[model samples]
Target: MARLLRRFAETRPDEIALADEEGVTTWRELDERVDRLAGALLASGLSAGDAIAVHSANRREYFEVMAAAGHIGLRYVLVNWHWAAQELGYVLRDAGVRVLFTDPAFAAQAGEAVEGLDLPTRIAFGDGIPGFLPYEEFLATGPAGEPEPQVMGSPMFYTSGTTGRPKGVSRKRSIVGMPVDVLALAADGFATTFSLPGDARTLLAGPVYHSAQWMFSFMAFMSGSSVVMRRAFDPAETLRLIDEHAITNVHLVPTQFVRLLRLDPAARQDFSGESLAAIWHGAAPCSPQVKRQMIDWLGPVVNEYYGSTEAGVNTIIAAEQWLAKPGSVGRPQPATEIRILDSDGVPVGQGQQGEIWFRYANGDDVEYWGDPDKTASIHRTGGLFTTGDIGYFDEDGYLFLCDRAIDMIISGGVNIYPAEIEHVLITHPAVRDVAVFGIPDDEFGEQVKAAVELVEGIEAAGELPGELMAYCRKSLAGYKVPRSIDFLPELPRTPTGKLYKRLLRAPYWQEASREI
Candidate 1:
């Protein structure tokens, strides 16, 4: 097993390996720091499989901790810095996090979350936080040498459950027992498949707490690529970073695409994106209009992948492939089987809408931490499992998602997928963000309803509902247009591009005797 970091350090010592708003770190610097950090984490009494929580925004130290934890055989939980104290505490307790790495910005929430918990180790990066060890000082406590080799560690990410509580997603084929060298080979293969070069530089513009974002950046990092990122995502800054770092790869979501397009013409025009090799997107349904515009402006660098925290990357579509087959999410990756099944669990013919299930040739499966029943519910007779998404394979074998099963509206017995309606509504010039769901109806079991966040400076009131419905009527059937629309100042969306539709739909169903 080759020591990838040390090899990079030995060969290209002065090359930048990581850069954040704080500063830049060279390969040699990063490698030495990781060695010390790995030793410190082990010296702190944490052992293999012990969980450590990182509750900070995107920063270099986050990767340092991740790299150190991986070499020491620990499960590192990437905590959403946006979560409140209660939510943070729930995950901390649930994951049994033995140590916590936080930033000054989130110190208050972290302080409150661990007030009464059994957690004792608390380390803060950047500015000092009360009751927490300074990151630099903590790193100094470990011996300068690299820690002994151990089983590899993996991340345990919590799904942002639209309803109820979030759950930590665990892999059945745990990497805990895998050799670090084997994992690096696999990561390199994955990165290469995405058109990443061995010396690729990746710009992380999204929150790493999301599984896709984590994989895009960290996997490349493991393969010896330098990483450049910022704590928060800014549309103009994102464009600047690409040119500034000569970034070769990046991970983004659909929302970021819309924002990038909305940037002033001057901001968009003064850019050289020649360094970009692949601009990957997923996590939410991207409107064909938005995707096409992106591809037009960025050339064939824009790509898409379909997967979830539970399922991993199942399929991917290149920009050219997407342009030819507009809405398809592409074909399955190697060794992945896609099955669209009807209500009776029978395989549906191609082009027929049904629940999409998957089985991996390597026997990888998803399991929710501490919830056996929840794990069993998503599994089927074979090794197939579902993420509750409804989609179908086209005649050309590309998968197209209709909507999540939970998001489907049954209005007067006619099934309406909100995603289809939302896709049309989002392209409206006046709309910024939108969520379509079902609301209780007297005669009908559910009625299509849309909650829209208007574009900046666009008035939310007036004949907007009628105009939007008229717009939808152009491309969709009468049954698919939202019956009513509500205008909100802002939609409830996470930084990772996931919408909390249940939050908006809950009020409308408070008095109704039904569950969405």
Candidate 2:
């Protein structure tokens, strides 16, 4: 990354590389900041591969810190902006972060999270915070010279930990230096496969803490593409940014789609969306009905991919291909290998449901930081790792995922996947958000249940539950339909729309004296 910045700074010194609320940063300014940050980190007595944590919202300084760490081969952990202090502390201590960076928005949480830790440095940006050094002051102390022996570093992302404590998904990095354009190459390969334009101009509304959002934002900078980032997501503002910035590519989740599509028609009346070359989405299952409507509205730029943080994205489906297959997550391209195997470790036949396993074609590996026993549990005899996702490849080689293995419901010898039910229910006009899970039942052992959050002004009373059941019955099997639909003001979800199925499923089990 250091080499890449040097090259860019020389070639496109005046070009706008990044734009956020504070305003734009030119390539030259960004390059200088990264060098100074690298110097600051080294002066703090941290060495290559040492970990630092950034628990803040999206901003220019945030990327500067990350790019600096990458230049010096230091692992920068992106702490989730939405995490509570206790949750954030678990990840900080587990990753062994030596330096912590935070912004005023999270100063209180950061302080609480790092309270008793042996942290050597706490740097604050935005407004000054007590017990934290000002960011600019710290940067000014650095030598303003490039650190020697520069090598690449990478961000360590933690799982959302909806089911358990967050685990650090650390990818192994080599100390050996690679080409300056290497980051662009890797990002471009994935972008190109999904129809991201060569002259990509991206608007990132998703928080940078998530892996998918980080790739769309920072990777554009690495590739010399213009990046417009918003600190938070707002449905109407998303369209305005894309239109105003003339963005060519975007990364989004299904929930964002629901919000954008639900906007008043007057708001979307002026949205041409013609500048978009691709609108890639992942991180959760999308409703097929909602997806088709988006394709209708956005002109078929809605491509999708399937992969986990542990495994680099493995499969991609273009807009055209997705229209034909409807629910498939494209075919595996170069650099990734995906396989589906049964519980017995036997390869599942085509179109048969099984646990999904994948790895790089060149045989790279990933591990949970400081948890070998947990790491070893996810690995098979060979190098492949399973994120515990269940899926199958269609006859045409497109991958179709089922629910996570742990979330699959088996009742009376029938296997039920909640995603299918949720997909069906999500298309209902009155249902704003929904989660389907299994609740303990003495007769059936486990029975399908749906927890729904309705749109504003739509009361859960009246025939809402019955209407939803009838609506789902149109597409789902009798046993697969939720036996009951409980109304809630909201469903518990990570910021990215991934459900905390365990949280919704826990109460009934414990009360029934069944172990979960």
Model 1 per-residue lDDT tens digits across residues 95-187? 999999998999999999998999888999965688899999999887776687756888999988676788999988788856767667877
Q: lDDT of each model, Cα atoms only? A: 0.90, 0.84
Best by lDDT: 1
TM per candidate: 0.98, 0.96
lDDT of candidate model 1 versus the reference: 0.90
Q: Which pairs, if any, clash in model 1?
A: none
Cand. 2 Cα-lDDT: 0.84
Badly placed stretches (over 4 Å) of model 2 are 172-181, 188-191
